[model samples]
Target: MGEVTEYVAGLHEPARSSIEGVFFIAREVVPDAEEGRSYGMPALRYAGKPLLAVMEAKAHIGLYPFSPAVIDAAADLLEGFDRTKGTVRFTPEHPLPEEAVRRLVSLRRDEIDAAIGRRRA
Candidate 1:
């Protein structure tokens, strides 16, 4: 987005915007989270560990879902696109599917609750 930062740089606008959207939804879904930059991308932390991270790649942008629940919920969206537990790769030419984005955020909220419940248990 901008010049080389102390934490994150080497990112272009398309990737930067994609990361920004991911961060926006993540914050809405995971308020109270500690947000920061990691490896030149946005990272969301809960309980002192990574809950999610976003990065833009040359061919695609990656939205990393740290929760299995989010992946399962978005299985259909992953049918043809590149994917991983820590990444959902897509392109700036074709924006990440909006429905998929909402699903991810919804699932993440559930995952956070479940993890909190597990910790309490």
Candidate 2:
């Protein structure tokens, strides 16, 4: 099995399903995103950068986009969700919506693309 699959499989119950759900949405948003580990967490890389990362914490599942600005921009959709500067925390009982996941991934992707463009300019 791949690293992501192995990581998700190692988790128990709701956590596994919750992580998988987020991964599913990310894949839908960026079909060509490459899967691997980032900072030891399962992540999807797009445009040669980490697009999203998923991890299970003691109480919630954490979604990391590695972009505080993207999280800030999605404040409306994150109303009822627990969030930190670079991570969004949601419980298995209250998983993040697919639409929210899609928006987060897309926004991060755009941000990365913009940064790449700036570097090349």
Candidate 3:
């Protein structure tokens, strides 16, 4: 198993399932995303850029897309979830909707693509 899969597999109940759910949605959205570490957290990387990272905290789960702009773009869907400039915290009891996760991965993928395009231009 990969580091990410191993990481998730090593977690305890509920947390494991919760992170797994996010990983499932992420894979569907970006099948080419690679398993890697970003900011010391296991993350999904697309086009050589950080796509997203999901981690379980003592009190809540954190979804880090690494872009404050992306968070702002999905602010409506994130209502009621505790968040900061770079992280969204949710609980397994109120896990992030698949749609939100999809949007985040898609947006970040798009951003990475755009940046690469710009660099080539």
Candidate 4:
């Protein structure tokens, strides 16, 4: 429990909650995942690399993944706001779709596995 995690966990509104909610969903999806603050933000990791990271932005909360392809795969749901290398902009006050988050997480893992296969190939 860090300052960032404490701050992020409180953003349970429509426009901002989704960012934290997605973080919640990701934490659950990863087996034996743990919570901590990294790089001045809330981070959830699996194995080693960060799986999900949440931070507050000027306009909205940023839900960032270690992999950018996951965000690309769920572009339909993302609907584009202020995005960066691996960050997706979302507000707690906006309606966050759970299914979309789930799909994105699941697909991201699949893509990761596929990428690993290519490397081994």
Candidate 5:
């Protein structure tokens, strides 16, 4: 199995399901994103840069968008969700909504695109 698949498979119920749901949203948002391990957790990359990562924590699942700006821009969508500078925390009982995941990925995609544009310019 691929690293992401293996990582997801290794997780127990609820966490496994939660991570899978995030993975599905990532695929939907960035069809070309490649899956692998980053920072010891399953992550997705686009255009050779980190897009998102998900890991099962002791009491919550963490979603990493790899950009504090993305988290800041998504404040509205993240209401009621516990978050740090770049990670959003949620419990299996209160997993992130698909729409919120979509917005987070979408914002991150835009950020990456902008960075690529800046580098090219």
Candidate 6:
């Protein structure tokens, strides 16, 4: 299994499913995203850049897209979630909406593409 899958599998319930859900939505958004690590967290990398990372923290599940700008752009969709400049903290009881997750991955993927001088035709 991929490292991300392994990491997810090793977690307990709720967190396991919650984190897995974000990764699932992310994979659909960026089908070419590869399993990798970015800044010590297992992440989905697109165009060789950190696309997204979801981890279980003591208080919440944290989603890191590696871009403060992307988080800012999606602020409307992220209402009610605890957010930092670069991290969105959520819980399984109030899991991230699928739409929000999709937007996050898409925006991050676009950012990566732009930075790497690659355009999707």
TM-scores for all candidates: the values are: 0.70, 0.92, 0.94, 0.69, 0.92, 0.98
lDDT of 6 by residue, 1-121 (tens): 7779989999999899999999999999999999999999999998889999999999999999999999999999999999999999999999999999999999999998889899998
* Error of model 2, residue 21, in angstroms: 0.8
Best by lDDT: 6
Error of 2 at 57 (Å): 0.7
Off by over 4 Å in 2: 118-121
Off by over 4 Å in 3: 118-121
Deviating ranges (above 4 Å) for candidate 1 = 1-10, 37-41, 118-121
Q: Go through the candidates in order and give the C-alpha RMSD of each one to the true structure.
A: 4.4, 2.7, 2.4, 4.2, 2.5, 0.6
lDDT per residue (tens digit) for residues 4-72 in model 2:
888888989978888998998898888888888787777899877889999998878899999999999
Model 5 has an lDDT value of 0.88
**Against the unseen true structure, what C-alpha lDDT does each candidate score?**
0.66, 0.88, 0.89, 0.64, 0.88, 0.94
Ranking by lDDT: 6, 3, 5, 2, 1, 4
Error of 1 at 10 (Å): 5.6
Candidate 3 TM-score versus the reference:
0.94
Q: State model 6's lDDT.
A: 0.94
Screening candidate 5 with a backbone cut-off below 3 angstroms (N, C-alpha, C), the clashing residue pairs are none
Runs with alpha carbons beyond 4 Å of true place in candidate 4: 2-4, 7-19, 37-40, 80-82, 111-121
Sort every candidate by TM-score, greatest first.
6, 3, 5, 2, 1, 4
Error of 5 at 100 (Å): 0.8
- lDDT string for model 4 (1-121, tens) is 7544677657645534555667678756655556765566667654444556767666776776667778877778767455666877767666447776776666665565565563322
- Select the stronger candidate by TM-score from 2 and 5: 5
Clashing pairs in 3: none
Better candidate by lDDT, 1 or 5: 5
Lowest-scoring 10 consecutive residues by lDDT in candidate 6? 1-10
Q: Which 10 consecutive residues of model 5 have the lowest summed lDDT?
A: 112-121
Cα error, candidate 1, residue 59 (Å): 2.1
